[model samples]
Each structure stands twice: as C-alpha cells, then as structure tokens.
Target: MSTTTPETKTVLVIGATGKQGRAFIRSLLFPSANSTPSSPTTTTYPKSENWHILAVTRDASAPPARALLEEAKSHNAASKVTLVEASLNTPSTLRAVFESHPNIYSVFVVLAYPGLGAPVTSQREKEQGTMIADLAVEFGVKLFVYSSTIPIGPDANDGIDESRKQKREVEHYIEDLGKKNPNWKWIVIRPGFFYENLEGVFGAIGTTMYRDGLKRDTTIAMVASEDLGRVVAGLLQNPEPYINKFLCVTSGPVTMREVLNAHVRATGKPMPAVPGFVGWILLKINKGAKDLVKEAEINHANRISGKLPTFEEEVERAKSVCELQTYEQWKRALVSGEAGGDGELARRGSTDGKRMSTSSWNNLSLMKLLAGRS
Candidate 1:
C-alpha cells in the first residue's frame, strides 16, 4: 500500500459510497483502471501516481464504505483511501473536510438526488452543489470537478426539467466563481444516460418501458460509470487544457434494439423486459414513469429526426483524456467479470446489487418515485 507523504496530493470525493463516487475512487486507486483511448491522438496517463482520496460518506463504517476500503486494500491502495464521515447538507462538516486536508489538490463534487431524507427539490440540489463549489474556492483548491447531468440539446432551455435547470445554475455558479477569481480553475462533466439504469428491478421496469414504448431505431446517449471515472481522473491529472469546459462524457449513442441485442450477445439470454401493453399501462398510470416517458419521447423524436446533435466529438475528446468503452464493450466486460462493479450482474443475472435489497429500495426516494409514490 502507498503512504501519504507531504508530497502526496489529496482529493475529496463527495458521494463516495455511491456508484459514481466509487467509479472515481477506483480510477484513482485501481491498477487496471478502464480507459481505452479510441484514437491515436488521445492522451493517456498512468493510474493513481501519487494521490490520496478522502472518500466522503455519511457513515464511515457502512458496508459500502467498508467495501470500498476493502477493494482498495486488495489493490494495495488501502493507505491511499480514507473514509470520511460527512454530509453535504451540513456545510460545517464539509468545511471541516477542507480545513483538515490542506494538501487536497482537487475536489470531485457529485451531489445526491432526492435530497437527504427529503424530497429532491431544485432549490435544495442547487444549494448543496453551489455550497461545495463555494467551499472549494474558499479552501483554495486547485481544481474543482463537478459531475453534472445531460444538457437539454438544441431546445429552448425552459423546456428542460427543473432539477436539470438547478444543475445548470450550479454550473453557472462555478463559471462565475472562476471569472471572479482569476486563479480558480474548474471542469464540469455532463455524463449522458447511465448504463446502470438497466441493471435491477428498476432497470427491468425502465428498460422494458423504453424498449417496448419508444419508436424502434431511436437511439439514446449513454455512459458507463467506470468510464466516467476514468474521464474525471484524466482531467484531474491534466487540468490545463479543459479549464472551465464542459465535457459530455459518453460512449456515443445506442438504440433500444442495440442495447437489448448487446445483452443477448454477452449473456446468450434475452434481456428481461415487460410486454408492450404492460409498459404502456405503467407509463400511463405512474407519474414518475410518465415523466420519464415524456423525456424519452422528446429525446427519441429529436434523435430520429436528426435534431439531436451527435456526441461523436465529445467521445473523441474523452478518448484523448482516457480510454473509453462502447456499450457492447462494457457489456462484454460486464459478463466476463472484467468490468469494475460487474459482480452484481455476473453473479445474480442482475446489476445494482446494492440497490436490489429491500432496505436499499426503501431508502431511495427515487425508488418510491418509480413506484409513483414520490
């Protein structure tokens, strides 16, 4: 295991126990971090050269936190990882994290959704995101990386979701902070649709709905959590070229048919999807699902009609920073247990192991949302 000397730079990762945070930690600590530079022009860097991670979580001793520590230990990175008990809702503790770690060179901010034990409001989400950005400036951190959601492409801004609007406000705040402080530097990465959204019971519902409901041949932009981490690590390693930039971190686009076909190719079994009528009924009856359907419909229409801008340029940029995997590549890795966090799918025929449990299901306000209760 590596030791944190005075020269070692630290990084404070918010939402450290969640999928996105875990992916970032793995990219920082794991020896075989997933990064495939797609072109000869893309630049690449070695993994976890001389870095320490302050893995921030609400509970330092929780199973997921413990699992992260254990994974790092197995990779000879135990000394490089530290579990920090903190919450974004509590600004004092968040400040304490920066105050305590003077050598922290970068901060990775990925705020939680559905609030902390409350419904997710745009105001609450924006408050939490901007608070962290403000804290980073106050602490004089060199780089601030915020993982944001997808942008509303080629459309009137007001047509987007409220939560999305709040995130954009946070991005604006970061940019404003940079302009006001000449010495400040930051990068905003807006990851496309998540592949993990196709993993468990919720995935079952969502995948089935999309597959059966959306028009055939309509493609959607997607990214793997593993790849998102690599992209962040690259920017952290080399922040000069991308200062104040927004990277669309994605593995290009894939259609619903292609997504299902990839699953069959990897596992030799068809994906579990509900019938068309059932999916249509759920979309009509469930408010949350209905909203999801509405969003998908807009995206699908844009994609099919050539109104959706291509993500080809974004994928190429990501390659220059880190190696990226296509959806098929990720699916193959997932089946062979080669991909990071592939166990849930490999062992159980379902992904999102952490989210499949009864307690986990109940804890997520998002899960309640899928059930039309939130």
Candidate 2:
C-alpha cells in the first residue's frame, strides 16, 4: 500500500456555508482516500490528506456554518478544516483573511446569487467576484477555481439572467490575470441548473415554470451541486491539463416531465403543476420568471439549431476527473436520506423537508407568481 503525504497546502473557500462551498470542502477533505485513476494513462490525483480547507463564512455561529464544522467532525477531518468569518461584500475583512493566511495555495469562490434574499444587481455581483480574483492574484495564490453558470447562448449578454453576465465577466478577468501572472493559474467550472433548485420555495417556483412555460420536448441541462464539488476537488489534484479552461459541467439533459416523474418516484407524491394560464401570467409580469423561462427556451432552440453546444464533450471531460451522479441517482440518494438536505433548500425556507413551505408565503414575489397575480 502506498502512503499519501500529510496535509500541507491550504485552500481558502469563499461562501463556505452555502451548498457549493460545503460540497467542495467535503469532497476535498474526504474524496475516497484509496481510489485510483480510471484511465491508465491519466495522472494519479493527490489524496485527501494532501490539502487543508479554510472555509470562509460571514458568521461562524450560524446554523449552516455550525453544520459545516459538525459535518467535518463526522468525517474525522475536524483538524483539516477551519472556519473563518469574513464578509465578501466588505473588502477590508476579505483582505485581512488573505493577509492572515499568506500561504494559501489556492482559492475556491462561489458567490451567492440573488444575494441573501435581497435583489442583486449584475454590477454588484461583478465587483464581489472581481475583488476576490484581484486579491487572489495579489496574494500569489497558485490555483483559483470559480464556480460559474453555463452559457445560455452564443453571445455574452444573450442570457436573460444578469448573474450569467457577471460570471462571464469574472471568467474573462481570471483569464487576463492568468496571462499576466506566470506563477499561478485559474479554472472556471460552469455548472448547469442545480438539482437543489427543484427542492424548496425556489423549487416550487422553478418546477411551475418548467412544467407550464417550457415546451414539452425541451431538455434542460442539469447537475447535482455535490457532483460539481467532487469535480472541482479532483481537478485541483491534477490541475495542469485544465489550466485556464472554462469547463461546462452537467450530468446530462432531461426534460421537465422526466424530472417531475423522478421526483414522484422518490417521494411518492406528485409535484403539482400550476395552470398554464397562471404560468403565462407569471412569465408576463415577473421579469425574473419571464427571463428565466425565456432563457431556457432560447437554449433549447439554439441547441436544436446547433448554435449552442450541448456540452456532451465537457461532461466526458468532467467524468475523467470525478464520477458524476445522474439526476435519478441524486434523487434516490436525497429521498433515501443518504444525502443531506440541500443547503439552498433550507436557506430558501423549506419548512418540512418536502419541496416547499405549506405555511404562509414568506417570499411574496414567488407567492404572487404562483397565484398568477404578479
């Protein structure tokens, strides 16, 4: 048996209390200590013991942050993970974090979208992301990994969501930084729709939009955020081949009806579909809902016309790094309680562990949309 080296390198993770952060830390700290590479010619990736995670959060006392620490302890990696409080919106605190940890080997950033239940502008999102990238460069970090969203169309501003544009801008900034700084590198992992998006208040809204607004045959690209974490950790272990590459990550494409059926099989309860007219009204009135639905429609059309890449090749590339879980597999795990409840689901106010809240509407916009009154 080969003995792996002790953990020496440090990786600072931003947004450490969120789904992507938790998953990335978990995958990085406990990625099957004895697994071998699938390809004979491929490099044998580094073991979990070779890296330490410095998980950055805004509050160390919050439930999610506490949960992260407990989860690490459960895996017997408590010593390997440390939680540090730092607000991403405040540059001074973030700079202090980097100044305190001068030996940070790499950075993994996943900024919150629709930040903290408050409406977020594209410029605000861009500033937060670019600030982090600039700090990483100043700190002389070796590898910087950013979790971004998949492209909706061929052009930069084609996507309806402003967040997509911000992500693209950050990607471009990282690429430029890498060109100027020869000592370090960067990688962007652009993930498609997260499985968690179908599990809470957002889930209900998303499912309604999917069932009523999208065409029957349209297949949306999807991936579990957990799989994205493992893929990032695995890539960092062998970062040479994928340097400065924008990897499109997806498990596969499946129709909305297919996803609904899978949810039924998992929970033994059918996902309720809103009336077509209600969905249409929501799409007409709510810019967020309308843009999201329109983006999916555009992606579907571009895919059929071959104007947009399907990302089949990118999926294959991701598979080379980590084993990806299909939607069916993830649904089974979620229902079986093998996988923890999605952090986003809980954050979005999932009252009873089912899809959405049964109580009064805390998010009025979503409620209005559901009622066709938005």
Candidate 3:
C-alpha cells in the first residue's frame, strides 16, 4: 500500500473584503453550485480541500471585514480563512504582513485604483502594483494571479487610456519578473465590464441608456463580478495549465436591445431612453462623460471590426476552466432578490460611494458617465 498526504497551500488575497476578492474566497472555500458545462457533475475543484486563504483588508473591524469573518466561520472547510488588516498603499505595512505569512504559496492581487477614501493616480497604481509583485517574487510565491483590464484595442500601444496604460505597464513588469526568475509563475486575468455595475440605483441609469441605444443594437462585453472570482479560483486550483498565460474573463457580449428586453421581462415595465439633448450637453461639459463616451464608441467599433472575440468564443474559453453564469442566470438572481441580500452588495455601495460621491455635482457627473458608457 502507498500512502501520501495532500500538500497544504496558503493563498494571500489582496483587497479580500472587496467584491472580486470575496467572490474568489467563496469559490475557493465552498463548492460552486454552478459547474462548468464540460464537467457538470464536478461540484468542487480539487484544490479547495487543501488551500488556506489569508484575506487582506484595511480595517479588520469594519462591517464588511466582520461579515467576512462570520462567513468564514459558517463553513467548516472555510474556517481556515483569516483576515489581516493591511494597506497596499503603504509598503512597510505590506512587508510586515507578508513577513508574517512567510510560506504563502500563491498571491492574488487586484489593484483597486482610485481606491476607497484614497483617490490614487495611474502613476501611484503602477508603483503599488509593482511593489506587491516585487514582494511576491522576494517571498518566492509560486503563482501570482493579477486581475487586470483588457487592452484598448488590437494594437497594444494604440489609443490606450491612462488607466489601461498603467495596467499594461504592471503586466509587463510582472512578466519581466517571471522572465528574470524562471521559478515564479504568473497569470493575468483581464476582465471586461462587470454585470454587478448594473445593480442598485446606478442600474436604473444604465438600463435607461441601454434602452436609448437599443435601436442601434449597441453591445458591450460584461462579466459578473462573482463569475470573475470563480475564474480566478479555478485558475488557482489548476495553475499548471495557465502559467504565463492571459485570460480575458467575460460572461456576455449582450447588446443594449437584449438588455432592454431582459429588463422588461424581469420588471414588466418598459425602460425609457435618455433625451439626446441631455446626453449631448453632458458629453460636452463633463470630462468623465466624454471619456466614457469615447470608450463606448471604441468598444462598439472593436466589436464590429472583429478586434474582440464573439460572445460564444469568450463563453467557451471561460468555461474551459470553470463554470460561469449566463446573463439570464445573473438577471434571474437579481430579479429573485437572492443576490441583493449579501455582503457583496454592501461592499459595492461602500467602495462605490467613494467614487460616486453623494454630492450633487458628483452624482450628476456619475450619471453622465453611466449614460455614456451604457
């Protein structure tokens, strides 16, 4: 008889109290109710049995962090997940935290630019991200999974925005580190627009604008925040196949028309279009609004020009790794109100409140920005 013990792996998750971080933690600790179509009967990925999550947060006593602690306690297998208060903005704090967990096997990093209560610039984002990557290399972490954004276009250097440019630079830095230290493995997950963005009060504005664009069948690629987490968890579970690779995570290539129809089906109410005069005025006056409009125009053109992959192709590629929810599935969860009563929604409001301030000017700015993007 041959006897062998499963090796235990510890994972450090940056921004662990945030939406994507929490989703990744949940997927790692629990069995996913939705499995990949290719393997419907596989309820859980194999690695969950031996992985321990070290979740990082700024305030361990905060409501969201406390809620995460409760969630960890609720599950028998997830009890090993621990929350540590630390700030990525402060390198000394990060260094202390990393030193405490000397044997961290993997690190999941999500750079939240313009982070809560601390509005950061693109240059700051690059510095923070590279700092963490350097620490990961120093600690000899085996796998480093970075949540990044897709390139603006087919050509890497073509018309990239400041935010996207910073992300691209960080990707290069991590890849370069991997090259220098062949022992370290890196994977980048570039996510599209999040479906969760169309939840709560902001959702109404998004749906309204989509109604306006329905006539032209304007579409945007999107993924559920939870689905992105699932993809990351799956990657962590089976990192060997994905080392040195990039995965563009998206759930739906849904058109505005389809989204409008879905809203009608869910609420039995018709969505109204935004007035052209209002859109034109906002686009002319608001810099944020102008940028969003340009992004939407570029995204639409890329979809039409075949620079981006079709919905089916993205779905297939995403499913090749883990199970994902369709737009309908996500909408049904929203309509049923099952997804609303959770910490994820609360976390979204808390984090977004910083960016989408309650002040009238900022609210109006956010509205205009959503109008352009949707």
Say which candidate scores most in TM-score: 1
Per-residue accuracy of model 2 over 1-374 as CA lDDT, tens digit each: 99666769999999777767876776677644212132112224645546788889888887777887887788798898888889877899999999999999999999887631235543887898989999999999989999888777777787767677778888788888888887778888888788776765556766787888888999898877767777888788888878877777787778999998887876688865555666667777676677777788888778778776645566677767766666666766665545643533434455323335552222335565555443
Query: lDDT at 159 for candidate 1?
Result: 28
What residue pairs are clashing in model 3?
A: none
Give the winner by lDDT: 2 or 3: 2
All candidates: CA RMSD (Å) = 4.2, 4.8, 4.8
Top lDDT hit: 2
When 1 and 2 are scored with TM-score, the better candidate is: 1
Give the residue spans of candidate 1 off by over 4 A: 1-6, 33-43, 46-49, 115-122, 154-160, 300-312, 342-371
Please provide, for model 3 over 1-374, each residue's C-alpha lDDT reduced to its tens digit, 9 standing for 90 to 100: 99667788899999787667877887677644222232223224554348888888888888778877787777665567888878877899889988999999999998764521122344877898899999999988989999877656655454335656678888999989999999999998888777655554444444544444333656677777777777887888877877887877876566766766775775576644456565555455545545544566676677678786543454466667765565555665655545432223523443423432342221244543544431
Sequence-dependent TM-score of model 2: 0.84
Judged by lDDT against the true structure, how good is candidate 1? Answer: 0.71
TM-score for all models, in order of appearance: 0.86, 0.84, 0.81
Once fitted onto the true fold, the runs of candidate 3 whose alpha carbons sit more than 4 angstroms away are: 1-5, 32-43, 115-122, 155-161, 209-215, 271-281, 306-315, 337-374
